[model samples]
Target chain A: MSASTIIFYILSAIIVGGGLLAVTARKIFRAAVFLLFSLIGIAGLYFYMNYEFLGAVQIVVYVGGIIVLIIFSILLTAESGSDMKKPALSRILFSALATIFACALTLWLIKQHTFHVNESTIIEPSVRNIGRQMLSTTEHGYILPFEVVSILLLAAMIGCIVIAIKIKPKT
Target chain B: MVITGVCLLAFLVVLCFFLGYMERKVAAFMEIRLGPNRVGPKGSMQIVADTVKLLFKEGLTPDGADKFLFNLAPFIVVITSMLVVAPIAYARDFQLWDINIGVLYVSSISSMAVIGILMAGWSSSNKYSLIGAMRSGAQIVSYELSIGLSLISIVILSGSLQLSEIIESQANGWWIFKGHIPVIISFVIFIIASTAEINRAPFDLTEAEQELTGGFHTEYAGMKFAMFLLSEYINLFVVSAIAATIFLGGWMPFHIGGLDAFNHIMDYIPSSIWFFGKTFLIIFIIMWFRWTFPRLRIDQLLNLEWKYLLPISMVNILLVTAMAIMGWHF
Candidate 1:
């Protein structure tokens, strides 16, 4: 197998395992930690894809910002302070069945579809090229989306500030 | 070196462990004391012994804690730092992947560390850890903006987001001496924000031992505690490396325009030595901040970010952009 394929397989395993653990773990905090691993695995995949900027952004925004907020909210809440329950056999069976069904559907689709196999060489995934494309006016240009992300972030910031404000203690 | 490609991760882990040893040794000297002298020559094996002790220590889960998140918190804190080992070119040809979005990728991935801390704090079912996580949640996000803004100046000036290219832009002359005032301001903001971003001293309310009783990881134990400690040091190295690369010119020989002898001496050493020497020096400064300064209150920290860093960095970016367009900076 090619080195890229090996890296892809390894990263996929990690991401899937982490995701599974995040949802399935009995302790709510361990699940959060598992989510972190899953996020890191996604970042690793982005690195392999040669989208280094995207990968860093993935780390900064999702891992650094959003997850931190989630943790803060979790910590602030008193109700979910304890682990609720362990997974039941029926629940596990149903989830397992769903996963298998999804896997089979993906496999069937893969067998039927024929994608354009580019018999081309690999290209350097550099930021300069991305910057150029981002600025271009054509359909592939992502300049609009890039600017829009800032606005979305601003909204989130406002929302967080509002939610985080504590009610004044009554006199 | 035939086994180099396959064992890259292993080497990184060992090297990081070695760095842990170095950090303590240096810290000891800085504080004017003998450190870890009982172990192998010069106390070298102490970290190993310590590692073993931690590994075997009893791991406990608080009775009221959310068990899953508590277990995952340290892992989240650690794994995020571990995975970001990519993109950095330690030497001429030693990079995990030279991804195009190098700068932004590092920023985003590193941010995940906060998530783990948050999980740990919230799930611990302890009031102290919860507040610690809450403080950290705000602390990291606020400082991130200025850090990104500071980095943007370099990205704009060098006109490339790739770490290598940023380093290459400095080959002619370091960005510090590129005679860009705006860049300098951004660099200043970057340092302050980064210090805060990592929740280091003056900004380390997350782990204020006295106030929060060890902050977000109050409930962590054994190997999990060790992971939190290791991840912090690694992150210190990572942030310092980025600073060295962006502001100080990573792996580039220092040249004072035409100081041939100094430039030649710089060239004699391998690039990795230069890169690491610069990185460690900055790490020392950050550690110094940790040891010397007092932690800021949560409100003060927030005010500092919004009222000061964010506005200043935004203005700095605009100034640098104008300078770039006018060809004012060399």
Candidate 2:
């Protein structure tokens, strides 16, 4: 096998292993860390595909932002070292069945789709090109979606502040 | 690639030692006290001796601690710091990796250091370490927003995330001088935010000795503890080097728009010297900050970022964007 293919396999192993460990680990903190590894492995996959920008965004948003928040909440609420309560046998069996079904459905979908690699249309994922395309008003421009995302983020921020604010009782 | 890795490791070790020595001397001068004058002529060998001592000392994992993670934490911290060194332009045409997403890579990778801190804190099974780690986590996450925004202003000014391109765009003049008020504001914010991001005083509530007693690495002893200190100094260097590269023009010699003779004279100095001089100047400024300012309260620290730095930086980006589009920057 080519070096790239070997590397891809290794990355996939890390992602799958980390995901498995995250779900199965008894310790809450260890599970969070495994989730972090799984997320980082996904970021590595993006980098492997030569999508440096996407890889960085993946790291920044997922591994750095989301995982930290998850860990923060875990630290605040849970006994990190204590073993998590085991699920019922029925629950585990159901989850396993659901996972297998989901995997089969995903595989079938992938097999059904005829993927095309459009080499001529592929743009260099440079920062300048990204910036231009993101803000452009022309066809294929991402301005509208970008603005929508920003608005969504702003709304989310306001919502968070609203939820977090303490209401003083009447004196 | 292997040779580059080896050299970078060597450079990191030497730089950390120098920074440790410099911090001691600077603190002493600031406090009007003699510091470390005993070991090898003005205590230049103090850090070396300290390292040797650390190497000999037994690294203890606290009873009931998670041994695997406790050992793993320091390596993660060190590796994250080392990874950031890749994109930083040390001298003209000298950098390990000139990745297109250099700024983003640095920010993203550096953000991972918090995980290591959290790991160290949690695995130690000590309340102090956990508290320190949590404080560090919050501080880094909050300050990261301001750091990213401030950096975005520079990226907007240069119109590229590439380190070399950013430096090249500053050929006529550095951003701090040429980009006027908005750039200057971002530069100041960058310095402050980055200082907090790296957990330096007066923003160092993470390791506030009076409260947490060495904070996240309280239970760590010997070389493991030394690794944390090493990572801190390396991070300090990386942050200052970034400041130098972005605002002070990396390895670019100081130049004027019209003064040909003086600019030519400035070029006679080596690019590496220019880079190091600018870096150290910023480093000294950061050190001066550590000694001069009192450690801020946790509430006050978070307030500074969320209330002041974040809002100011957000507005500053808009101003920079306008300036960039208008061709207002010289």
Candidate 3:
């Protein structure tokens, strides 16, 4: 096999293994760390595909932002050395069934669609092009969705502030 | 690629050693005391002796500590710092990777250092380490936003995320000079935020010695501790180099629109020299701040970022965006 293909296999192994460990790890902190590895592996996949911006975003948003927050909460709320409570047998069985169904459905969907490799139409995903498309007013532009996402984030921020702030008791 | 990587690693070790010595001298000068005179030529060999001592010392893994993570954390921290050097242009035509999203990559990779710090803290099985790591996590996370926003202003001004292109855009003049008020504001904010992000003095609440006692790496010993110290200096260099690159212009020598003779004279300096000179200048400024300012209280530190730097940077981005669109910048 070619080096690129070997690298791809290794990355996939990391992703899958990390995901498995994240769920099965006895300690919560270790589980979070496993999730971090899984996320980083996904970022590696993005890099492998030459999606540099997307890869960086994956690292910045998920690995740097979300996972750190998750770990912070874990550290604050849980004892690091303690083992997590095992899920009930019924819950495990149901989850296993759900996973199988999801995997089968995904495979079926992939088989139904034929992906065309149109070399001529493939544009270099440079930052300049990304920026132009993001803010462009034309039909293909993502300005509307971009603005919508911003508004959604703003609302979330306000909600978080509201929830976090404690009113002082009357003297 | 392998050769360059090896060379860069070697250079970084030497640079870190020099910085260690420099920090001591700077600290000594500020405190009106002689520092490191016992070693080679006014304590110039102090860091070397210290490194040797650390190498010979044992790296202790405490009882009940998470051994796996404790061993892994220093490597993670060191590797993240090393990774950020990839996109940095040391001189004209002297960059390792001129990736399109260079700035983004630097910010993202640098952010990963906090994970290592967190790992170090959590795995140490010490309360002080845990508290220090948590403080570091909160501080780095909050300051990262301001750093991103400040960098966004430069991206808007340069109209490219590529480092080489950004430097080229500053050929006529540096952004701090060309982009005027907004750029200056962002520059100041970048310096302050980056210093805090790197956990330097005034913002070194992560390892606040008085309270936390060595902070996240409290339980570390020997070469493992050295790795943490090395990473800190490397981070200091990285942030200072970034500040130099974005604000002062990477390897571009000073030039003026209507001053041909002066511009020609400035170009006489080598591109690499220009780059290092600017970087070291910023590094000195950071070191100066370390000596000058008192360590900030945790609440005060959080308040400075969220309430002050964050808002100013957000507004600065808008101003920079307007300037970029209006073709106002030189």
Candidate 4:
């Protein structure tokens, strides 16, 4: 096999192995750590695909920001030594069914699509192009979505504060 | 590429030795005491002895600790720090991988160190480690805003995220002089934020010895602990080099307007020397801060980032954007 194919297989193994371990791990903290490994594996896949900016974003936002947040909350609420309680049989069966359904859906979709491998049509993804598209006002621009997301985040922040702050009762 | 990787690894080891020794000497000089004078010629071989000792020492994983993760943390920390070294241009023609988004790449990758620390803390099953890791999580998340925004301001001025282009823009004059107020503000904010980012003193709440009892890596022993220490210095070196590259002109020598003769004389010095000289100067300033200031309280630390550095950096970004729009910068 070619080096790229071998590398792709290795990366896929890492992602799958880490994901399996994340779901099956007995300890919550270990599960979280496994989740981190899986996320990093996905970032590695992004790097392998030559999405440098996307790979960096994957690591920074998901591995650095989101995973850290998850671990922080785990540490705050759960004891490190305590393993998660086993799921009920019904719950396990439902989850297994859901997983199989998702896998079948993905496979069906993959079979339905005919992906053309057009080498000439593939444009190199540059940071400048990414930046222009992000801020552009054209039909394909992301400015509106970006602004909406920022506003949504602002609302979330305000809502969190409102919920967190305990108003003193009338004395 | 393999040769460059091996060479950089070698350089990292050698640099860490000197950094460890220099940090001690600086601390000693500040505190009015001699530090490690007997190891070898003013303690030059002290780090060597320490390394040897650590190598032979027992690496223990606590009974309650998760074996895989407990062993994995230090490697993650080291790898993240080393990955950032790729895009940095050591000299004019000396760069490992000059990626398109060099500045953004460094900023993003460097932030991943927190995960290793968090893993180290959580897997250890130690309360002190957990607390330290939690503090680090909050601290990094807060201060990263300032670090990122300050860098954005520089990126705005240079109009390129690539390191080489940014350095080229500073060829005529360093950004600290040419970009004027916004650059100065961003530089100051960057230094402060990055110093905190690396978790040095005055903001080292994570590893606050007296309080947290060695903090996140408290359970780490032998080479594992040593790796953590080494990555800390490597990170300091990387951040300082970036500061020099962005604000002080990477490998470029100082050139005044209408001073062709003087500029030519300055060019006689090798580019690597210019790069390292500026990097070390910034590193010295960071080390100076370590020795001069006491650690801040956890609340105070967060306040410094969110209340002070973040707002200042945001304003600086706006100011820089305006300058960039109006063509006010050199």
Candidate 5:
């Protein structure tokens, strides 16, 4: 096997292993750590695909921002040393049924569709092109959604502060 | 490339040792006390001795701690810091990988260290460790805003995210002087925000010893503890190096438009020396801040970022953008 293929398999194993551990781990803190590893494995995949910016963003936003936030919340609410309670037998049976359905659906979709490789339209990942597309005003531009997202973020921030502030009762 | 990576790893260890010794000396000088003097030639080998001691000491995992994550945190911290070293320019043409997204890559990877800190704190299962990690989580998130915006101001001025291009743009003169008031504003905010980002004193709510009792790495022992300490010094160096590269010109010497003779004299110095000289100068200033100031309260730390640094950085970026649009910068 080629070096790249070996690396890819290793990364995929890490992603799958971490993901399984994240859901199955008894300890909540360990689950978060597993989730972090899973996210980092995905970042490695991005790097392997030569999408450097996406890889960095995946590390920054998911591993750095989201996982830390999740861990912080877990520390705030949960006892660190305790294991999560086991699910009911009925719930486990339902989850097993859901998983089987998902697997069958995915397999059926894959068998029905014929995938074609299109090498001609693939663009090399570069910051300049990303920046231009981000701010451009044409049909393919992302400026409108970008501004809308900024406003959404602002609204969320204000909402958080509003919810956090405690109101006083007057005599 | 392999040789360079190995050399950089070796250099990182030596630099961490040197910075540790320097910090002790500086702290001693500030407090009017003699620091370690009996180790090896005026305590120069103090850090080495400490490392040897730590190596021989048994690694400990606290009873109730998450063993795997507790062990993994230090490695994550060290790895993130090491990843940042690749894109930074030590001298002209001396960078390992001059990636197109150098600034973004550095900022993103450096932020990942916070996750490691959080993991260390949470997995320790100690209340103090959890508090320290939570403080770090809050502080880094808030400070990252101003740090990123301040950097974007510079990116707007230079029209590139690449460190080499940013450094190249400052060849005529440093950005602090040449980019005028807005650059100076961003530089000041950048320094303050980055100092907080790395969780140094005056903003080190995470490891506030008086309050948190050694903070996030309280449960860490032996090599694990040493790794955390090593990453801190490396981070100090990395932030200062970036400040030097972005605002003070990476490896470029002092120059002026009409001072050809003076510029020629400054050019006699090697690029690596110039880079390290400026970086160490910034590091010294950061160290000075640590010794000279007291730690801020957790509330004050958040207020300082959200109330002060963030707004100023946002405005500074707007001013910088206007200048860039009007073709006013160097």
Candidate 6:
């Protein structure tokens, strides 16, 4: 394998392994911490793919913001540090089966697609280029989706506020 | 790979002394007292002495903590900081990957610092550790929004995601100058948001000694604790470098129209020095904020992010985007 491919494989392992640890760990805080690592690994992949802005956003937003929120929620809930009870045998078996099924579905989908991007296409990392492409009428312009991202953030903020605010007790 | 490895080692070795020296000097200047004049010319080798002390000290694993993660936390903190430096535009053509998504890469890696904090907090298995970790979670998330909005404004103005492109776009004049009022506004918001994001003073409730008692890493001792301390300074360095690269123009020489000889002279200094000079100036400012301001209450911190900076930056971004489209800027 090429050096880049080898690097890719290693980061992929880290991302996947960290994700599993985040979800499956017995302690809630440990899970949250693992999620942070997983997100960082994915950002590394984005950097390797030449998507610098996306990588930084991934760090600033998801790894930095979202996981931090999760940690806060764990803290506020009062259940963060306790040892969670292991699932009963039958439930554990059922959950394991479900996980396998989900993994299989994803693996099957990955196998079905043959992905390719032209290797000769050169690009600049400038915000100016992205802005131009965004506003352009061609295939590379991403203007429409940019507005969508804004709306989505607006919705997220509203939802977070709603979740955070508990109605005051009636006088 | 070999070069990158060497760079990481060099980064750590330099940071060991610089952070140690900066902390002593800043603390001394803050209180009307002198600090750290004993070791190696104004405590230059103080960190070295400290390192030797920590090296000989015994490693302690507290009872009831998860053994595996406890060991993993410090290394993770150092490694995450190391990884984020890759995409930073050290100078013109001196960056690692000048990718279209450079901004995203930086934003993502920065978040990992929070994870390291979480690890230190939880793995310590103390009540203070838990509280500190929780506070860090809330603080980092809230500050990140304003940080993102401010950065998005830069993306709007520079019209590029690459670090090199961002620096190049400001070649004629730094973004703080060339881009309209909104860019300057965003720069201001960004600096504040980043200071908060990195848990510097005025936003350092996570380590509030009066409250959580050393905050998240309270239970840590020896080299593990040292790693946490080292990571904090490295983070300060990384964030300042980024702010300089994005807003101040990384290693791009000053260019006022019709001043060739002076501008050429400005370019004579090594790119790395120019980069470090700009970065350290910002670092000093951050340190000033730490000493000058008192820590914000957790509620006040969240309110500042949500009710103020976020909204202002969003509006500014819209204005800048419209201006960019209308050809209103140089």
Q: Score the docking of each candidate (DockQ).
A: 0.55, 0.72, 0.84, 0.78, 0.74, 0.58
Q: Each candidate's TM vs. the true structure?
A: 0.80, 0.95, 0.96, 0.96, 0.94, 0.86
Clash pairs, candidate 5, are none
Chain B TM-score for each model? 0.93, 0.99, 0.99, 0.98, 0.98, 0.95
Model 6 lDDT per residue over A1-171, tens place: 899999999999989999999878998878877787788789789878866666676777787668777766776776666878887899979988999999999999999988888679767755556666778887767786887899999999999999999999999
True contacts kept of each: 1.00, 0.58, 0.82, 0.82, 0.76, 0.95
- lDDT (Cα atoms) of all candidates against the true structure: 0.80, 0.92, 0.93, 0.91, 0.90, 0.80
Model 3 lDDT at residue B280: 91
Model 3 stretches astray by more than 4 angstroms: A137-140, A143-147, A153-171
Q: Single out the weakest 10-residue window by summed lDDT for candidate 3 chain B.
A: B64-73
Residues B1-330, candidate 1, lDDT per residue (tens digit)?
346545765765566678778777777877798878999998889888988999999988999876666787788677778766667778766666665567877777777677777778877878898888888888887788888889988888888877888889898788988946887788778888988877788888899998999988888899889989888877777888888888888888777767888888878889888788888888878877766677788899999999998999998889988887887887
Which runs in model 6 stand beyond 4 Å of their true positions? Answer: A1-12, A15-24, A33-62, A102-171
Worst lDDT run of 10 residues, candidate 3 chain A, spans A75-84
lDDT of 5 by residue, B50-87 (tens): 99999998889998887888889999999998888888
* Cα deviation of B310, candidate 3, in Å: 0.9
Q: How well is each residue in A63-164 modelled by candidate 5, as lDDT tens digits?
A: 878987888788788566688899899998998899889989999999999999988897767888887778888888987588789999989999999999
lDDT of 2 by residue, A1-171 (tens): 999999999999999999999999988888989998898999999989988899999989997898988888877875778888999999999999999999999999999999999888878888778778888979989786878999999899999999999999899
Question: Lowest summed lDDT over 10 consecutive residues: which window, candidate 4 chain B?
Answer: B306-315
Off by over 4 Å in 4: A119-121, A143-147, A157-161, A164-171
Tens-digit per-residue lDDT, A57-76, candidate 3? 99999999999999898889
Q: Pick the candidate with the highest DockQ.
A: 3
What is the fnat of model 5 with respect to the true interface contacts? 0.76
* Alpha carbon deviation, residue B96, candidate 5 (Å): 0.5
Could you say which candidate leads in lDDT? 3
* Candidates by lDDT, descending order: 3, 2, 4, 5, 6, 1
Give residue B133's error in model 6 in angstroms. Answer: 1.4
The TM-score of candidate 2's chain A against the true chain A comes to 0.84
